[model samples]
Target chain A: MAQTSTLDRGGATPSAPARRPTAPRRSRGLPAWAVPYALLLPGLLVIGGLLLYPLYQMVEMSFYKVGLRQIRPNPRPAEFLGAGNYTEVFRSELFWSSLRNTVVFAAVTVALTLLAGTLVGLLLHRLGRAMSTFVVVGIMAAWATPPTATAVIWKWLFDADAGVVNWALGLLPGPLSELIFGTSDWSGRPWLNSPATIYLVLVVAVVWASFPFIAVSVLAGLKSIPSELYEAARVDGSGPVTTFWKITFPLLRPVFSVLLVLSVIWDFKVFTQLYVLAGGTTNREAFNLSLWAYTEAFSAPPKMGFGAAIAVVLTLILLVITGVYVRQIVRTEDVR
Target chain B: MEHVSRVLTRGIAGHSVWRYLLNSAVVALGTVLAGSVVALLAATAVARFRFRFRTTFLILLLIVQMIPAEALLIPLFLMVRRLGLYDQLLGLVVVNVGFTLPFAIWMLRTFVAAVPKELEEAAAIDGAGRLVTFWRVLFPLVAPGLVATSIFSFITAWNEFVFALTLINDQGGYTMPVALGFFTSQRSTDWGGIMAASTLMTIPVIVFFLLVQRRMVSGLVAGAVKG
Candidate 1:
């Protein structure tokens, strides 16, 4: 490193000019063209081994007969089951119900998240900077909290005996509470026990966590829209609702699409919140695809093959939904 | 609110919530430390250089971002166990890095690109070598963007649950989010303790948000609007 030492000694001089690379310096050690690959090496290896390889294995495992006996010590080799796992997965009633639950949960949550997120986004856009910042920070707290933490918070909020929701309901006039929800008894309502009510709570938690992203995205989109458009609408004496439908919605269509596809993918695979809320695999009927797959593979006498099948199905569904969205994105990118 | 301070004075599953806090800190910080370096190097490369697979690389990062981490749960757990990293905080860090690295690199590239190329040439013209030039000139310029990416990694790793649950079987190794899961069961629920633990888990993220809130909004909007 004489060259290095010389450079250092030279660099110690405050007036030294930074050395410029010429022909000889360009030929040193690694070629310039290989530098990018070198930079990408570590990240690619970690992701490939951990993400891509495991994904391939997951799909492969779906085609095998992978029970506990095949996995533990003194293990027997796994036998290839071809479409056997798929047949079983398709035939199982629980699988259908879980799939149904996944679809319904996704549909409802996506709609709610977009609707609420857009409203919040518009509110944030329309408000004074100080008020917007205040609300954005408030919403950011919910968004930044860990998913499991959000679940815990909401679970407490809906607690049957001590929950604020029930407590507030109790404060409402007794006959009104009875006539509206058909339950005057707000305390000890067992909100998490039933599937329908649990989904209601789940929707709240998912929407609460999700809306901030959409809000921020839409706000950003709104910020990008020219003031001229709004001024033009004002000049035409357009009403606020008409202006939103004619200008805002059409302009934000791409952002909405991205948000919709993402929300669908996220909501369909929801696991931790449901798992925490349900307390385990005990509530079979409340299962979403992700949790259902986890239980199928990792529950006692783990049926890994069947679990893989469920995952395969889940991945395929997501791929199809994401496919259409990606095509839209790609086409737009091409146009740009 | 009471539960937050209550946790400060109580333990859960035979360990203080402080232990889980320590575990989460290890994972979060470790992920940020390792994830940011790799991502920064890659981002600098992708941002400055015209490489053969440049567009493909950027697109791959977006595709990876889209893949649901949950779909890989069973397999990632198996990989961690096979590596003999199960029930370990290091495993959590590694997985977090892998998942978050693409996003970090992708975001940081925008920041790196925004830095003028002439600055690098000027640094070279000033006697600084490759690494020093980067540290002296590029690093400070990109620090705001790097901070944004670091926060993202910290939050993602800190709050991650499913991997923590499956990877760390032992109670002692559990992250706070996983521990929060244990507070509820079919037989009984510890609402107070759970609330306390969850609140504790959320504090660092909120504090972090306040620190970087303004830059993060502008950085995200600038990069994503055209996108």
Candidate 2:
């Protein structure tokens, strides 16, 4: 009876040694969901305190009659001008023109980037490994260059006088005099002064600076595709174009969509390129929303409230685009 | 040989090349170092701890990232001015760290999490302390992540222009971006010089990426596909 009792206790794990095994596991505690949140609190607080507060202040400023004068002590209360600033902004012809320009710029830039990126990605897919590596390096190099530097380089190249572009144009088959010194002499035609020309120049500069990023991202997407798909397609006697259209394109659609949405948001808020290229002045016709906001805030009399309103609008636009994109990304992730 | 000769003749050279190289190196290195420290700490915390508001923090980070650098210029400028850091490398570093911290942390977190918990547990069983376990046993496993995140931070800080333009005023303190701006305003806007400057600016980034591109590619693929 004593032997049987000892054996049962050892087997059933009612003794101290049996409990010891479970103690370590219990000591670690549950996979506490709260712990992750606690860890995240500090970062969240910092972002909220710094970024979100300023954003809130901007929103508050937009609804009031605030300006350069308001930066100092004033007797007059910041008048609760409900949507007055928004109304003024919406009614302004400059505002409308700038809005149109912004839309056009974002659309064109995103379209060009996606198309160029996709083509480059396809090329990388088809090319030999050595060549692909070389191209990838080149693309990364371009992507990594300072935007301001690229802007400067592009502006120099497009300069009317003693510019490399003009010099090259002088060599092309044409009336050399006409090409270099046209009826409207190249030097006389200020590229930055004309609204249409300035827009084109800005587009070119932005495209050159941004396309490399899209290319790299697309390349990443391309690399994920299994090689067997290509083999399967080839066995079915599908041409290269058809194979890409059916097999590769479908697989890459998710990444392409995400890239498209991100590029749109990014392009819409582009300020430096426009600011540098335009020399931080409104051309009336060429100005975009970002430049418009900057001008409103920093120009004479300094309508900080109006500027804030414009920024608010821009933020809302970005938020809406991001929301849609995030939903799509989340849905795709869930499905997978 | 003709192409080489043409490039040499037409490229930005002489005194400007040295200046450009110096400016870019200073800004890139300073920003990268500052940004990496913040990223490393934040990423480790996020990976190791399970606290309340973790999801909110992640979401907030994504949102903040969408708030284009352009939008932050006014606030950042005001803050910098108030802090008396205007036109300084320290100021640039602060802003670069702020701008880069979110993405760096996000990227680094994945790497930190990729490390097996059992390794740390085994180290603990061997009487190693938490810090010792982290530093000695787990650090090497996430070395690739560190490289990847650092590359990102370096690239971003190096390429930054808007805030640098708005914040930096003194030519003596100018970074590459600001220097490029000055180059733009100089008489004649030398195309060759500008191109040469740009080409030079692009080189270090290219080299860095080349060195780590394989690791980055594999890391990204593993994280996205496998996760």
lDDT of 2 at A120: 85
- Lowest lDDT block of 10, candidate 1 chain A: A1-10
Candidate 2 lDDT over B1-227, as tens digits, reads: 44334434543323344554566577767877866665666677767665555555655666777776655565666567677888877787777777877767767787888898767655544444445666898788888789888887888787787767767776666666656555656634555555655566666777787788766655543333221
State in Å the error of residue B68, model 1.
2.5
lDDT of 1 at B164: 86
Going through the candidates in order, the fraction of native interface contacts each one reproduces equals 0.51, 0.27
TM-score of chain B of each: 0.92, 0.85
For model 2, the stretches where C-alpha displacement exceeds 4 angstroms are A1-42, A72-80, A170-190, A334-336, B1-30, B45-52, B192-204, B216-227
For residues B1-227, could you state the per-residue lDDT of candidate 1 as single tens digits?
67667666666677778898899899999999999999999988888777687777776676666666777877887778778888899889988888988778877888998898878765654655566777999999999899998987888898888888888888888888877777655224567767677778888989998888777766655444333
lDDT of candidate 2 over A167-188, digit per residue (tens): 6765656565575646433343
What is candidate 2's DockQ? Answer: 0.25
